[model samples]
Target: MVRLPLTPAEVARGQRLGALLRRARGERSMLDIALDAHVSPETLRKIESGRVATPAFPTIAAIADVLGLSLDAVWAEISRPEHDVTPAASAHTRPERLTA
Candidate 1:
């Protein structure tokens, strides 16, 4: 059966997911992680670089499993605000109000 191409939104989501995975994988060799995930190093490289946007679900599951991270956590990271100001603003404001 022919698989349908991914939508633009799905591609963006996949890229975001890949970026999150990369961040969580700091200090780990891509080859090692890929081997653990049961995917080729080149495939992992492409996923990390967002060259292969919309990677298969099983592929993502494998990577997430090897990373020891939950799927929900990965999705949450991807969906997090690109420019999260709440934490930064709260850090400054919370101290002032408590002192005042």
Candidate 2:
């Protein structure tokens, strides 16, 4: 399968997703979260570090569930904003933190 290169917008969104998941993780160990999410620690690490710019949906959903983030919130965090809103710009705004 040929995978196209990610656009700048996609890269930006992936970074935002990583940051949001990291914040929601708070004080938890990455290993613990990764194990609970049924993903390898390295996989989680890559996602959190934005090395995997466009991860599979199931992978993200599992990680988000482990972090107690709603899909809607995840979308809001990573999706491009319309009108005057910018996803990166919105990242500057504080979001509700999640706890284990």
Candidate 3:
């Protein structure tokens, strides 16, 4: 299939997703997390580095599971564009706070 180029918003969201995952992963080795998530280290690297701008849902779900992150939390994170990209702000903010 011919894929259209990603818009700026999509690319930005992907970067936010990557940053969130990297923070949630903390000091854990990427190899270990990738293995546990049943994905290749290269895939994890791409996602974490924001190179794979719109990863498949299953791929993201698997990695999020390994990182002990809930989908709600993940959405809450990447959905917010104006918030500061801190680990605490990204991983723990309430969705309502996005408007507050």
Question: Could you estimate the TM-score for every candidate?
Answer: 0.70, 0.79, 0.83
Which 10-residue window of candidate 3 scores lowest in summed lDDT? 91-100
lDDT of 2 by residue, 1-100 (tens): 9988999888877888888888888899999999999999999999899989798988887888778776667787788553424444343333465332
Provide the overall lDDT of each model, using Cα atoms, as 2-decimal numbers. Answer: 0.70, 0.78, 0.81
- 1 or 3: which has the higher lDDT? 3
- What order do candidates take by lDDT, descending? 3, 2, 1
Which residue segments of model 3 deviate by more than 4 Å? 83-100
Per-residue accuracy of model 1 over 1-100 as CA lDDT, tens digit each: 9988887766776677777778768889999999999999999999988888877878987887777666666655555565542222221111211110
RMSD, each candidate, Å? 9.8, 5.6, 5.0
lDDT of 3 by residue, 20-39 (tens): 88988999999999999999
Name the top TM-score candidate.
Answer: 3
For model 3, the local distance difference test gives: 0.81
Preferred candidate (lDDT higher): 1 or 2? 2
lDDT of 1: 0.70
List candidate 1 stretches off by more than 4 Å.
1-6, 79-100
